[model samples]
Target: MSIKLGIIGGGVMGEAILSRLIAQQVYRPDQVLVSDPQAQRREVLSQRYGVNVTSDNGVAAKADEVLLLAIKPQVFKAVASDLVSKDGNHSSASETLPMVISILAGVSLTELEAAFEHQPVIRAMPNTPATVGAGITAIAPGKTVTANHIEQAKTLLGAVGEVVEVSESLMDAVTGLSGSGPAYVAVMIEALADGGVAAGLPRAIASKLALSTVWGTAQLLQDKQIHPAQLKDQVTSPGGTTIAGIAELERSGFRSALIEAVQAAYRRSQQLGK
Candidate 1:
């Protein structure tokens, strides 16, 4: 059966994109197909989203339009092997080849193209916050991809959050920064909440305060289009509490620590790609 969108995984990230796409009416439930090995996952997706589900990966891989790969990177090769026939072909000769978009981290275009044969491939890096629809994703296209292929990918990924186009060379850096950024931001919020507790706030109140403060600060920076240093200066009046906190953070090398964290993560992404 022909479908508009084929999804090769029904995991958290896949479900997030699928739910958003359906809720936004980008694709009707009838036009989508999801493939997962677990019967429970297939059942959950079918019942919750009212979309077709299958245990066979090849069925979804041959979709009439776009195919999304949301599975873990470690299993990509093994799962991709399941899509190929004995003749080493996945797509029907008469059908329009599907555009393949992979959200699997560290799986290079070289590997994907080799597996998919002539299909246009786009590699993407998206963070965990995508589950909540507040994430950002960066996509890099393969040699065979055209502008239309990219716009189609943006539409699919945009269902979850913002989409950015970047060269494959910078994908590892994207992974280190925005791709793993949610964890860093979460840690900062958690630490801030702990600090509030140390200063006499209740745990629940501190948590809420920390979360709101970070979120509001981000919104303010984005809306106002101001530099972070400018925001810092505005809050750091002479001998004020904000300045005192800033001094402590600076003394503890907070900024450098974050920078180093991204660099370290970038290095790790490179290692994984190799």
Candidate 2:
């Protein structure tokens, strides 16, 4: 039997994608190959998922079907060297090498294509919420990538949540909004909980309220196809408590602060790519 999916990197995000794929039965455990540097991680993945696990990046990189690069950007150079090395003896040796789909932040398609040389490469930005199948991922495909390749990437990525295709030019913006957006939302949740405590609610209940409110509101917006402004207007009866809070939020520059945070994150992502 052939390994249909090869995963490089066995960290949190890697495991999140792996577990979801397996849970959805998109690929059987036997068809997956996971590579990690640590023996303990390799052992755990093998035992838990019954997938083939190895320390050789080359083995995973040369997988027969799709290859996922879940490694950190910092280690990509070392890993790429190993994958592309002449001594590896796998370079150009087969025509069935997998298309590369990368979730490595700050790694560009140009760099991925330069390393793989011949395979279709896709750069993906996925948020932390993907761990629970509530997140969204934006993918940018390389020049060699076709409609079929995009669909393939989407099928795999969709197991975790939603997958959207965007232009490479908009990836940085996607990074700013969705990639780092979770942290911003987490902060908002925290602050909302704190505000509830300040208003005399118990800490635990306040936390739950904050989390549920955000989650439900997002679901409602999507379900109703309503704009956020429409939701706000619907909730904010003239001269009511909701409008009172909205006025305070506007005065405190809440919207501008979030906007600037995204801009800053976008700039930082650009810097890292350089």
Candidate 3:
């Protein structure tokens, strides 16, 4: 049987995409294939998703129409070397080269094209929230990619959450923001929980409240389509406790700290690409 999708890794993010695609009925389990070096990982993915699994990347490269490159950036070159031959060519077994969508951080489209050689390549940055089918992925296409390729990429990724099309140049910023934003949000939740605990709430209750507040606030913002400042103004009455807390947060440079964190992460992402 011809494979519809080939996944190059079975790690958390890779599994997230695979599971989401299957769960959303984008692709059936038998239509997809996964390649992982670890025997345990291959077995787990096969058992969990009922997809064909292989230790050889070449099998994925040769068999599938579309490939999801979710391997770590550090091992990308080595993995690509295994897929292509010494002559810098893809397998002749497939009439056409596979369209590749890479979720590997800091791997540029140019680098992907160089490795794959004349194949369509898309660079995507998806956050950890994808594990829960709540990720927002930003994708940039290579020169050779067509409209159909972009649509296919979006269709597969959209299963997880939102899909945003961007130029390759802006990918690092996307990486810093959405790709790293979950950690920032997690920190904010922890801080909120800490504040509740300081005010005499039980740790478990505080944590639950903090998590729920964050989740609820996001849902409210998205559902209402209202600006955050508008919501803030609505909740913060004159001389109220909310206003007082807001004032303290402003005085403590909360917004500035988050901005700097993204900037720092962007710089780190750029360095990794080099």
Candidate 4:
């Protein structure tokens, strides 16, 4: 099947996705259309990715087989309103309606369906790490979606990262855990660097080592298929230095703090959706 993709909003997330898809050669440049009101952003994306460009959301939505809504949550209603108006302009009800995949934070499938009049909609949460092609995305499909639509959404999203199918109810939790997870990890890396600096390493080397440690550890944990707890055990000798540090972390309520942070994010996401 010919896949024509239309993307609304060419901000950081939109540009990141387009760059990855272009680099991977998964879809021809001509098959993709990007719409952003900012002329500078449109010009940069057009020059960088060599895709069709437009300032009209309706034009982009109507030109493609699949439409991706990458705008901010605040602007979603406006965009949806425009799409509905375009649909109304068509004389026939049987006119083809593009399947929509939304990456707007806190936007729900129900609201999207309501705005688009019960069209097949998929809501996805993707993280900043997608810029580096190392992101994880979670998707929840609406009731009207078909198997083919689901697969197509997966294929498009998977171009920039690993895509996981999830229940709509868990989407906020997924956002908390993974969508905001990168910043948490980044903060930990910064702290680890500070620790190394206090331990007599130069600031530059400390930062590099701290980041490498996290990267290498994550690679080992994933590649070895070992439980993270088991990996931690492997590094901690009985009653040794690592165990002492672990004790301090537990005493300081590190795990509890992380859990609470995730819960807080989840709650905020839910509130925004409402």
Cα lDDT computed for each candidate against the true fold = 0.91, 0.90, 0.89, 0.86
Residue-wise C-alpha lDDT for candidate 3, range 159-221, written one tens digit per residue: 899999999999889989999999999999999999999999999999999999999999999
lDDT of 2 by residue, 1-274 (tens): 7888999999988998999999999999989999999999999999988899999988887677799999999999889888777434136624656889999988889888888877889999999989988879999999888899999999999988999999888888999999999999999999999999999999999999999999999999999999999999999998899999999999999999999999999998899888
Candidate 3 clash pair list:
none
Off by over 4 Å in 2: 86-90
Off by over 4 Å in 1: 86-95
* TM-score of candidate 2 to 2 decimals: 0.97
Cα lDDT tens digits for candidate 1, 169-192: 999999999988888999999999
Q: Stretches of candidate 3 above 4 Å error?
A: 86-94
Selected candidate, larger lDDT, 2 vs 3: 2
Superior candidate under TM-score, 1 versus 4: 1
TM per candidate: 0.96, 0.97, 0.96, 0.95
The CA lDDT at 205 in model 4 is 100
Lowest-scoring 10 consecutive residues by lDDT in candidate 3?
85-94
Candidate 4 Cα outliers beyond 4 Å, as residue runs: 1-3, 88-93
Model 1: how far is 197 from its true place, Å?
A: 0.7
